[model samples]
Target: MSQSTESTTESNPFTRPGFIVAAAMVVALVAVGIVIFLLPKGQSSAEPAPASSSTVTASPSASSDGGKSICGLPGSAETTLGTAPQSKWELVGRIATPTDPKTFGPGESDSSGFRTCFAHSPTGALYAAMNIVALGSSGSTDLEQKLADKLLVPGAGRDAAMRQAAADSRTTGSSTPIQVRGFLIKSYTPGEANIDLAFETDKGALGRTTLSMRWMDGDWKVKPADDGTTYMGATQIRDLSGLILWSGV
Candidate 1:
């Protein structure tokens, strides 16, 4: 499951046009299916799943309080925006994931095989979004189901994801790995956040997607789209011009 992030001038599989298309498709399906699996029957490459009501307005108490506990985890008072935040990269379930112990979490884990406990700050939300995508696309069916059960908000979207996981039996394909290259925080409140994430393929193809996060129970969980996928508004990008570039790769 370990692969190099280096670029090569020689003929390589990642540089091929076919691999780029597959990689783009894999990015689109990050929260719905494994990166190496094909789209569900009848889902078209040109047609995206309907967008979900993932955006939420900030509440009156949305401001950051460094001394207060937002979700039973340590709180961060930092409210700075429009800059790349700090992160450390480590392999989580076979995919490179970002982590910040002081802020963002998976600060705690249990026998259920799910990572939890993240800070309730903007940076924390950013890290949570990245980790969720990485873990969901880690190519493990059981892990995917566990994430859907534990880290996704309880809703029709979660129910659909649970059903899809139970029914998933597709063989892995030759899709290349997708990496998080940059991000933008579309909006945030203490209770909810809408984050835009930038993804890149090994061949340098770029795409963007949005994730809605809600502070639930004592941790941050992804709020899936109405269709049961973890992300929405996925589209190919020409470059990383407008993003605050950040990556663990």
Candidate 2:
């Protein structure tokens, strides 16, 4: 399972036209890099099935906001709070359309300024939380740890898995922020949401997978099952100007 900041080069030799640069990167790094596998299709075993491509489209505009000029807050009566992740992770701003075409959202392009406590909608809130979890930090007070505590389901095993992934030493790359392309919300309720997110690493490693989130403590928290293939383990990137290549989901 791979999770981290998003990226995919434009003029990269490994990239091809009409293809997602990030997706191409994932294909290229499948051997040495991490993998973001799809949800098991009712298979009780933790072993991942296989990687397959999915079709994703950009978000469409909606009058749901009713002229309320704020970030794409979902239809909910909640307040969002701004937070800095231990000052270790950098915010490249929020993006629109998520890169993938299968996800749904309000048609907008600016994917920046995510809040911790209030995201208005499940998609926005969960996306922000996922970004926080995917990012890696080396500071004494790791921001990822804080987010894991707040966003993930409370458990020793969960915490340990998250910590282990964040501290992985196999990755030798840049520390640049991730770039989210698109997301698919499988199911969303007032209390819980299931999401499939697609992201690319600065090194051109692309990943997409599903996550389970539940509203707790007045906020959305990722409650990944004790499966080892939840998301890609966190790692550091050495460069951001790398190639962006993608074939399919």
Candidate 3:
């Protein structure tokens, strides 16, 4: 990438346009069991379109158990997995993310970067998976490297991701906005969870991906696939037939 392209990617990693194209590229690569955080080039440099005026603000419910957990964060009694979670949308890195403070946390944000803490429940795993996806696709290689180091499971996958981040830094691309459409908890246990997330691009393209999360150090960290990438089994969906059909839009 050229110096100008690198500067643009660093300056505004999340608000670029044509993310659907980038997502398509990812899907194609993942089909062959390879995943890389590369976005398509030559997209318009225009600012992202503003979110709708009717966007709802998040109102986290108070925990029934006096708002405390074993992790010393706000806790919720919701343990059973449900298809639809009560969530409101808020922009994170220009993507509309779902948040339910009482249930899933990002109970706290690390001053160091996009790293945030989540609850130790199934719902928390769901939130963590989504948040990581958004942050990983932010189009800033530096930010991605930091996230991989701090939020991914400690193993060869994490090491490989760090190396990939360093290589990606030399490349540059713009990021278009995408929104969380729905999710499905394939399986859940106290120690591990598999979450399937549905997404809609600004141009109405639909895509889906799965994340494997492991409970680590009192928080949920993405468990990398055998290929050493956090996102496993990504594909474009023609419809939301298998999804729970929920969205903040």
Candidate 4:
């Protein structure tokens, strides 16, 4: 059997050192089979326009047509969430580790994190309560525009994905987090806030992963965590919670 362990900082939430719990979720999983996967922000009904190397914000620039100013973009002084009103990203796809980060490209990486339904705290941090779902090594994402539609936690897309992952995790009358922590950053709009986070599982740990997001339309959205992965898009369901896993719920 593969040996691993993940420890979440149960001390002070603010001072606690974020964990990655990626040992088995990443390294050991490679010994078997599987790999990593993948954005965020914007609160508008994207009219399906041209997007290829999006026009990044300048000093917290403005979105097209009197759009809001986003804080999650690539260049912004002291970022904050819900800052952008226009910004789009896509999830080309996912790849296995023991592979090349370059070949995988970038967008967002789900490492030691809880359910996607979990919301980022107003303070721009993930809540400790999320440690419960931080199991396995899998990731997901959606375009920045989609975030505008469903920026709150437990949105339909996130909830659905979490339930699917939790249920699919079943094996031998039990579940085990696949052990995956995506680590990579690339580009962004500008002035978007970031969530420096990470988590732990029974089999692994993630050191710290900074989650970037911007406020658009009226809610917060996830930005590219880095050349990690692109936004996969949204689904139709909603609900809570977060990272660090054990044997059962």
Candidate 5:
């Protein structure tokens, strides 16, 4: 539910890409900011149950035209374009893993990029998605988004209504696309989605992490994460929001 953008030109407090620094930041936030909760096992009950990739289901309630839901939910794909709701969901917590800023290619200005998606999932529920598009070197933003759209909402790309809207949003233009690299589909049922992503800038490797999320209020939301309950939602911080200048001896 919480979608934040880590731009090449802004100072995002919740965004970074070093395993150690990210871990520290996440620990500090959860310990001080999050209220924390103990949720029932309705969606996230039996851990995570992954379904076959061949089948597509309809959402329980969808407004999309076709008979299939986006991401193969249960009903037709809903009209979640710009109308996707953003309120009500709480920013419970977040985490990130930073890495040595690595160059995307030789003589490429040594870019520095970081990846950190906010967390927002109920204690024990899972938000499910059928497909996922990891960040990669795809030059086309439209292609990137389409890859994500189809994964996020199945059948969306196949339907007429969803197709036109997405087209409109693109021809209009955008600021910059988050250089998401790896996309992995976690679950086919509701309340289950895991994102394995990395952020690479013109400088080098920023960070990487596997994020877990759930579907809430008809939208996919991220959840607090951790290698385990004891180290859940941990981040590894390499530096703060500002640039880190290295001075050669």
Candidate 6:
């Protein structure tokens, strides 16, 4: 009876071949779960990091000397103009007629006037201001005639008028480039304008003058002040204001 009991215990359902196979399958499933937990995340299952919400921007390209140019031509003088006028001019009442100097070219035009006279740029006006001194000092009739043409006035008394003004201002010697301190727009009309400008001479001489300008052929041209006197075609440079600190002229 004891031998029979031992045989029954050995042949129990828990020790059956089917039960052993089921236990092996359960062990394999647990091993697979552990391997899956230990494995590294890859492209197929991993998520990407959160992106930033802010955006990057670039700086502007307008330089301080961006709009400054001589005779509507790019030159070193434009950069040397100090505080005469920055790239942008201060318009008092109306918007300026000349927007871009590049379109004006180096004072060239097919209409009746000087190529330089057509320049509406502050640098162009500065060029004319400085060069006018030089021209007056030289007392060249050809230059005077050019001025008369630019002013759209009679050329008969233009030379004598310029000569007298040059003598009066003591600018008979060679005139140098003008270093403009600043400009003021006294008045403005659709086709005409008047301006006051303060400038420093090459020899540290300072002066102020009022200029009358007329707009024609898509540009501004300097005109004589309408005093209705003998000096109608003549303009004078007044004395300097104060100390000349800048030596760059």
The prediction achieving the highest lDDT against the true structure is: 1
Model 3 CA lDDT for position 160: 73
Please write out the lDDT profile of model 1 over residues 1-249, one tens digit for every residue.
112222220122222221011223434333222244333465444532232323222222333533343335565544445667556788765456877665467676567445667777777788787777766554556666787788889988888777866666432322455787777788877778888887776566567778888876766788876657676666666556556777777
Worst 10 residues of 6 by lDDT: 14-23
Candidate 3 clash pair list: 16-175
Question: What is candidate 1's local distance difference test score?
Answer: 0.60
Q: How many residue pairs collide in each prediction?
A: 0, 37, 1, 62, 65, 2
Error of 4 at 85 (Å): 28
TM-score of each: 0.70, 0.44, 0.68, 0.27, 0.27, 0.38
lDDT digits (tens) for residues 148-211 of candidate 4:
2243233454444333333332111112333222222222333244343333334442233444
> What tens digits encode model 5's per-residue C-alpha lDDT throughout 1-118?
1223223112222222211113123322332333233232442323212222331222344333332222233332322211111112211111111111121001111122212122
Among these predictions, the greatest TM-score belongs to 1
lDDT of 3 by residue, 1-249 (tens): 355444443434332222112333343333333444332364343442332333222233444334233345543444445546666667656666767654566666555437467876666777787777767565656667777787878888777767766666432433435677777888876677888887776666556777888776777888775445676555666556555666667
RMSD of each: 10.9, 13.4, 9.5, 17.4, 18.0, 40.9
lDDT of 2: 0.38
lDDT of each: 0.60, 0.38, 0.59, 0.26, 0.26, 0.33
Clashes of 1: 0
lDDT rank order: 1, 3, 2, 6, 4, 5
Tally clashes: model 2. 37
RMSD of model 4, in Å? Answer: 17.4
Q: For residues 84-173, write the lDDT of model 6, one tens digit per residue.
A: 332322221111112224532334433432235434433444434333322332323344445544443333343444443333322122
Candidate 5 wrong stretches, greater than 4 Å = 1-10, 15-178, 225-249
